[model samples]
Target chain A: MVQFLQQIVNGLSLGSIYALIALGYTMVYGIIKLINFAHGDIYMLGAYVGFICTVQLGLGFFPALIIAMVTCAIIGVVIEKIAYKPLRNATRIAALITAIGVSYFLEASTQKIMGTSAHSFPDVLGTQTFNVLGVVISMKQIIIFVVTILLMLLLQYVVQKTKIGRAMRAVSVDADAAQLMGVNVNATISYTFAIGSALAGAAGVLVGIYYNTVSPLMGLVPGIKAFIAAVFGGIGIIPGAMFGGFFIGIVETLVTGYGSSLYKDAVVYIILIIILIVKPAGLLGKNVKEKV
Target chain B: MKKLVIALFVFAMLAGCSSNGGGNPAGDGYKIGLHYELTGEVADYGNAELEGSKLAIKLMNQKLGEDKYESVEYDNTSSTTEAVTISTKLVQDGVIGVVGPATSGASAATYQVLDGAGIPVISPSATANNVTQKNPDDENSEVYNSVFRICFEDSYQGAAMAQFAYDTLNAKRVVIYGDSTTDYAKGLTQAFTDQFHKLGGTVVATEYYVAKDTDFNGTLTKIKDMTYDALYIPGYYNEAGLIAKQARAMGIDCPIIGGDGFDSTTLVDLAGATALNDVYFTTAYTTVGASDALQAFIDAYKAEYNKEPGMFAALAFDATNLLMEACEKAGSNNPADIQKVLVDIEFDGITGSFSFDATHTPIKSVLVVELVDGVQASAVSVSPKM
Candidate 1:
């Protein structure tokens, strides 16, 4: 039971990172209906930025996190405007392909610049562990939990209690109707990317600190896993992505802890299949009736 | 417009002809392919091996009093498919033999492609057991007769470590956390487990992770509750370093032992100095107790590159020298001739003096290097009791 609890602790730390990245995937899908495959690479860029902030610039963790988030937010807005905007009217598949292209471009360009090697993220939070009821938790894990919850709450306030948030919901529901009702759809979409990418960037910094290693290709697997989490919880649903991230993280950790690590990915996908079979929409997603 | 198109086409042909004219001078030397990971995740290993191979070639040329060898080099970027592509290009360029693609995965890819073309290929650090022969566990497995290596195979190194852990360190139980995605790690794991069990030491738990995986805390937490005397990680420095850091951070301060994959400066950078205490790994060569010949090679390498040469450089130097010696013995730069000579040749190298056994693996000694406070303290030579 202690072993199980310890695994859960590990899972939560990993899941919070997935949750942070999943938010970006869900928000962009909610607003523009594009999958934003490059969302993961943006998270990777955020980690590198954080790496520079802490290692080269000699900033503390909070400052590095904030700067990384801000830098990624601008990059997110620029990517949407330049890459997705041109193909807005073309085809959804076209935009999706462009997102993939953007992902590759970011990875290749970063590799070309930084070289393909892993960099050790500086240990800003010194190692400290706490034992509660035979379970071990580290200071880094606690920071991850605190940061993720705060960001999620801040995201909740932005989505529910702000004018821009209402505009975002309006665009998601009916872009043409929202435009007719003076919603400024393009600006709302850009804001959506900004907020989502900022969350991803924060996740990146957290992961760098937690893992103590960063590389150019670090975001690829997490990006796919987070996308799966978003879909498992109900893609395009704000609360669903958060729930899905934690759910997948715990399940993955438990599977890896008890069962074989080889089957962890397979088990995650199988659960998704079962969930989708029961409710075509995700666990937190509502089934929308199709209109012809 | 048609006339203009024809004129442009003619101009392009002329440009291509001029570029082709600036190629290698005819019959100046024999072209030996140097395919390696020049710029990728394992670029450190590749570039070091390249330097060693270049140094060997320089000395070989000076001895022969002429440029009897020329390197046709290509960077595989630490990719298996890229290694295959480079092998095809090397074959097309009429190279006699190829020397690299340092890691086992890429070396395996090149061997599969080059074996069919009857090219004699040598890998400096592709230590996986099955690189020369397929299905090392099976007796009837096919062998890549033309493929060979300079360093001892992974099984030898793995067994050596297991023996050291049991006999020298006096550990009765060990837990293995290995990389499952690479043949190198799998080979080491298999040999270590078999040898440890044979030595009457119990293996507590065996956990696996793929390359690029950073989160071992979940798995580590599970293993923490288990009873184990030592932990053996059969993987590259990237994941091993991270595991060392995490393991130490968790206060699981038992000794950690590994194979040659842990021989990299990046290991120190990744794990940090404080976390690397009581770590041990098997390597091909060490400066701890160097022979005069080995020290000479080290000094020459230092004088040439102004940096300490790692194990990869030493192995590649030996591999290049071995190949060039075969070429000289065969009295020709023919792949078939070089392959025939290699099968029956005995070579002396900085790493050791050895001849290839039936499986094309070198019968040589391995150094088990230990770290004290994250710095190399001592290396003791050990032979696996196979």
Candidate 2:
């Protein structure tokens, strides 16, 4: 039972990271209907930024995290403006393909700048472990949970209460109608990217601190897993992304702990397949009519 | 305008051809190919090999006139497909032989092209047994005739580490965590498991992970519940270093053992000194205690590159000089003659003095180095009882 509880704690910590990244994918999808494959690279960029801030500039963790978030937010807006905005009226596939191209470009350019090697992220918070009921939990894990929950609440307030959030929802529901209603669709889209990418940036910094290392290609797997989490919970639904992230993380952890680690990835995909077959729309997704 | 464009295109084509030594009237050197990973995942290993090969080539030219030999270099980008493409280009370039594509997967990927072209290819550090043998799992598997390596096969280090753990460290119960994606790690894991079990040590658990995986908390948490005397990770320094760091953080402080893949200095960088305590890894060379010849090579390397030469550089220096020795023994640059002489040549290198076995793997000693606070404290030479 203690072992079970330990695995649960591990799962939740891992899940929180997936949740942070999934928020980015789901947010972009909610606003523009583009998958934004390069969102993961933005996360990678965030870690490198945090790495520079802490390692080179000798800043503390919070300052490094905020700076990384702001830098990534600007980058997110610029990427949307340059890469996706021109293809807005074109086919969705074109925008998706361009996102992939952007992803490769970011990976290759970062590899060139940083060189093909992993760097140790200096220990920002010294190691501290606590045994609660024979289950070990670290200071890093506690910080991850606190930060993720706080971000989620902040994201919810912005999405549900703010004017820009209303404009975003209005545009997602009916862009033509929202434009007719005097909503700045372009501004809303850029704002969505900014917010989403900021969350991803925060995830990058937390992961760097948690794992104690960062590399050029660190974002690839988590990006895919977060995308899966978004789809599993119901893409374009903010609450669903959070639920999906936690679910996937816990399931992956439990599978790896009890069953074969080799089959853990396979199990996640199988659950996704089952979810798709049972309800074409995700767990929290609703059916919507498509215009031909 | 169209006529001018056509004329310019023709001139550009001529320029391209001429630049490949096609139009150089004074070209008389025997061109050898240096196909290595200059960029991408394993670029560190490839770059070290490049430095070693360059130093060896410079010395070789001084010994046997400047125009006697020359090398054309290409980067395989530390990828298998890129290796195949580069090997094909080397064949078309009509080089005598090639050295490198540092990892086992990339080196093995070049076999079909180099084998059919009858080119004798040598790898400086490819350690998977299958790179030189047809099927290393089978006892009677034939050797890959033209493919050769200067380092001992993966099984040698794996078995050596197991024996060291059992006999020296007195470890009876061990856990195995390894990278599943590469033949190099898989080969080491298999040999370690077999040898440990043969010596009557109980393997507590066996786990696997793919390359580029950053998290090991779930797996480590599971392993913490089990009883083990030591942990053996058979993979490159990239993942191994992270594993060591995570394991130490989780409070599992047993002695960690590994293979030659853990030879890089970057291992210390990834896993800090505190985390790397009580770690031991098997390799073909270490600078802890060096022979006079190796000391000379180290001094020369530091003078040239302004950095210490790692195992890959040392082994690649040996591989390049050994190739030149074969060329001299054969008395020609013919690939077939070089292959014949390579089989019988007894070249003394910084790593050790050994000739290639039937499978083209060097019969050499494996050194197990112990780390104290991320510094090499001791290295004991051990021969695997095969």
Candidate 3:
């Protein structure tokens, strides 16, 4: 029972990270209805920015994290403005291809600048284990969990109460109606990207702290997983993204703990495929009536 | 006027003949090709091997003093297909010998190219046992003659590490993890498990991860439930670093052991100082406890590159020096002559004294290193019992 509780705590901490990253994926999908593949590369960029700010420029973790978030937010806005916004009327495939092109370009450029070797992120928190009811948890895991929850709650408040949040919902439901209601549709899209990119930045920092390493290609797996989480919880649904992230994390952890570790990834994908087949709209997604 | 024209013509003819002599000579200006993975996942390994070849060529030219020989370099992109393409290009360029494909997988792909050309190929780091292990009765056995390795085979390293874990650390039950994508990981894991079980140790659990995976929570949880004395992760530093960190996070506190792939400083940095404490691995050489010659090489390397030489660099340096020694002993620019000399030659290297065994693998001592606060310290030498 003690071991079971310990694994749960571990799973929760990991799930929180996935939640932060998945929020970025789901948020963008809600507003734009396009899977921004470059979103993951933005996370990688955040890690590199944090690395440079902290290790090279000698800033503290909080300050470096803020700078990383702001920098990534700006890049996100620019990318949406230049790449996606221009192709809004084009086929969805065009936008998808552009996203992929942008992702590859970012990865290659970063690799060229940073070299192909993995860089060591500085340890912001000291390595000291704290015990909680016969389960020892590291200080880093606690911080990651706390930060993730705080960010999620803050996002929830923004989307539920704020006027801009209403505008975002309006845009998601019907872009023409939102513009008719005096909402600056383009501005709302940019704001959505800014918020999503900032969240991804935070996720990148948490991952670096948890794993103790950063690489140019490090964002690929988590990025894909977060997208899966978005789809699993119901794409375009806020609470759904959170639920999916935690669910995937727990299921993957349980599978690895109980079954063969080699089958962990296989299990995650199989669950996604099965869920999709049974309920195409995802766990919390609504079924839409086709105009045709 | 006729006599003056004859003299001028003779002078022009002599100059043309001398320029042609400088360009090419019959069986004199031998070309040695190098195929390495200079880019991709294992680029670091390829870069080190290439640097070693460069250093060897510099030393050899200095020793030769204007000898008519040239080295041609090619990038193999760490892919089998690329290695094959590069080997064919090298053969087309009329290289008498080739230095490396840097990995067993790549070497296996390009084996036919060099074998068909009858050009001897030597690898600086390819450690797979089957690389040179040929079927004696088969007509294609001659394909094995053209290939050799400067590093110890996986069998030697596996058994050596297992014995160290069993006898030195008294580890009775060990868990094994490997990367499924790499032959290096698979070969080392198989060898270690075989030797450990043979020595009456139980493999409590065995797991695997892909080459680029960053998470190990699932695998770590399973291993944590069991009672294992040690964890053997025979894979490269990229994934190994994350595994070490995640294993610690999951509360699997057993000491993790690995092979030469863990020699990168990046591993220490990736795993963090606290998590890497007590982690052990086997490597070719360490900057600490180096021989006098090895120390000089390190000093020169530091002076040249403005950084300490890692184990890959040291292995490469040794390989180059060994190749030069073979060239000198052969006293000819002929591939067959160099091949013959290489088989019988024994010389002290930066890592240790290296000589070829019957399988064309190097016979040398392997060093066991312990990680102290994310830095490699306390290196001890081990030799295979056989």
Candidate 4:
């Protein structure tokens, strides 16, 4: 029981980071119907930015995090403008392939700039673990969880109440119709990219603090898993993405704990298969007609 | 497009001209081909080896000033393709033998070409047993007879450490966590597990993660409640350092043991000073109490590079000088004669006394080092039991 609870805490902490990344995938897919595969590299960029700030510039942790978020948000807009906007009318496959190309380019460029070695992140928060009822809790874990929740709440507020959020939903539903309704679909799309990329950047900084190392290609696996989470929760559904990310994290941790660690990744893909077979629309997704 | 064609044609002609010197010498000095990763993922290892080889060549030239050799060096960038390409170029360049390609994977990738071309290749620190031993993945599964390494095979490391754990530390229960992708890590893990069980030790659990996965929280959390006398991690410094930090944070109090992969100074740098307590690894050399010659080499290295030499550098120095000695003894820089001479040569190296076994693998003792306050303090020298 205590062991189970400990695993849950571990799961939640891991899941929250995944959720933050999943939100990016979900948001971009919602607006443009493109699975911005380069989103994860944005996360890596965020970590490096925060790394430069905290390690090189001697900035505080929160300030570094904010700077990373802002920089990545701008980068996101620029990437969409240069890479995606031109290919908007092209085939979806072409855009997806370009997303992958962009991802590889970002990875190679980062590796060239900062050697492929993993840099040890300095302890921004003092290293201290408190044992509560035989379960260990660290400051990084608490901060990661709390920040993720608060960010999600802020996201919910923006989506539910803000005019930009309304435009975002309008564009996601039908871009032509949203343009007809004077939503300025291009601006909405750029705003969506900014928010999504900013979230991924925040997740990147949190991971650097939690894991104590950052590398050029660190975003590849986490990015893939977050994409899987988006798909598992129904792509383009925001709340469902959070649910899926958390679920994947908990299940992955539990599988590793009770069963073989070797099977952990295999089990996640297996669950994805089962989910697709059972509910193609996902838990929180709805079936909608599409125009060919 | 025409310019590109012209450039490629010029490159091919230059390559063809170099092939004219294959397996033969013309000048007063012999040419030796060198491949080291100056830039890449493991560039640190490559760069250190590069410095050591350079220093060794310079020392040899000073001693035999008139007969000093010229080395043709190339950067493989730690890529297997580049390693093979450079090895091919080296053979074509008519080098007597090649000194290094740095890591085991890179060395293995170049072996097939070097072996078929009958070129003798000695890697300074490639420790995977299959480098000279039979690689099951090979098309013929035959030993690459031309391949040799200066460092002790990884299997010996695992077995020696397990024996020490069982006999010295009285660790009857242990858990193994290792990298699954690389042959070096897998070979060590298997050897350790076999030797541990043979010594009446029970391995409570064995876990694995690929190279990229940084977070070991899930695996550590599972082991949190389990009873184990020690934790054995056989992987590179980057992952090992992080694992040590995360394990310590999770309140694991057991002694963590590792292989030569933990030899890098970055291990201490990454794992943090406070978390280094009880961390131990089996490595090549410790300069704490060394012979005057070894101390001299260390001093020279520091003076030249303004930094301490890592194990890779030390191994490379031995590799280059040892090959130089073989060339002198054979009275020729011919690859075949050098290969024959290398089998019988017995010499003292910076790392240890080196004598080739039947397979050209060095017979040497492994030094165990412990981390205290992020410093590698020498522990014990574990020799192979007779």
Looking at model 2, give its docking quality level. acceptable
| TM-scores, one per candidate | 0.89, 0.91, 0.85, 0.88
Instruction: Report the lDDT tens digits of candidate 3 across residue range A1-292.
Output: 7667777777787788788888988999998899999999889888888888879998887898899889888888988887899999999999999999878666655654576678888888777888888887888888988888888999999998999899999999999999999999999999999999999988888787677677877788788888888999998999998999998888777777777777877898998998899887889988888898
Clashes of each: 0, 0, 0, 0
Runs off by more than 4 Å, candidate 2: B1-30, B38-44, B55-71, B134-142, B296-309, B328-333
| Segments in model 1 whose C-alpha atoms lie over 4 Å from true places | B1-28, B37-71, B77-80, B134-142, B290-310, B325-332
Pick by lDDT: which candidate is best? 1
Top candidate when judged by TM-score against the true structure: 2
DockQ of 1: 0.36
Error in Å for residue A178 of model 4 = 3.5
> Which clashing pairs does model 1 show?
none
The TM-score obtained by model 4 is: 0.88
For residue A158, give model 4's deviation from the true position in Å: 3.2
Stronger candidate by lDDT (1 vs 4): 1
Enumerate residue pairs that collide in model 3.
none
Please give the lDDT score at residue A38 for candidate 2. Answer: 93
Residue A78, candidate 4: how far off, in angstroms? 3.2
Compute DockQ for each candidate against the true complex: 0.36, 0.36, 0.24, 0.35
Question: What clash pairs does model 4 have?
Answer: none
- Model 1 chain B lDDT-worst window of ten: B19-28
TM-score (0 to 1) of chain B, per candidate? 0.86, 0.88, 0.86, 0.87
| Shift in Å, residue A211, candidate 3 | 1.7
TM-score of 3: 0.85
